[model samples]
Target: MKEGIHPNYREVCFVDLSNGFKFVTRSCANTKEMIEMEDGRKLPLFKLDTSSESHPFYTGTQKSVDTMGGRVEKFRNRFARSVK
Candidate 1:
């Protein structure tokens, strides 16, 4: 509720560097590159590695760990032996 004490919040475009995907959202972050979007306006383009389009958790492409597999089970068995 204070005035003149907050970072500038404006519409900015987030560009996924790996896949060349672009989306616009409000951000207080800074960037040096600017690109013209489909709307015909130049927005500050921030390159990122992971976004909702490519992130494992959001896209549901997560790599499942084999917790019940051979190596893990062997480790657990060894730990149980050490404890006993």
Candidate 2:
């Protein structure tokens, strides 16, 4: 609650570069871009390579680890020590 000691926290517009999805939330991130919302209010814009909207895990495009040609089993076998 002290003046001039805390970072400026305000509503920021986050854009998913992969999907062009935009959302507004409060943050203290530093950005040089700005975007005007539908309400005619300008907010700081932050660009992201991947967000929940475009991420493989969130979009259900992620590949199963177990189905990756048994790489996990190969690794375990490669380093596994035999017990005498």
- lDDT, each prediction: 0.87, 0.91
Error of 1 at 13 (Å): 0.4
Ten residues in sequence with the least summed lDDT for candidate 1: 64-73
Best prediction by lDDT: 2
Query: What is the Å distance of residue 31 in model 2 from its true position?
Result: 0.9
Q: Tell me the lDDT of model 2 at 23.
A: 96
Candidate 2 least-lDDT 10 residues: 75-84
**Residue by residue across 14-38, what tens digits does model 1's lDDT show?**
9888778888999999888898988
Q: What are the candidates' C-alpha RMSDs?
A: 3.2, 4.1
- Give lDDT tens digits, candidate 2, residues 1-84: 788999879999999998899999999999999999999999999999999999999899998868645887778777788633
Model 1 regions lying over 4 Å from their true place: 69-73, 76-84
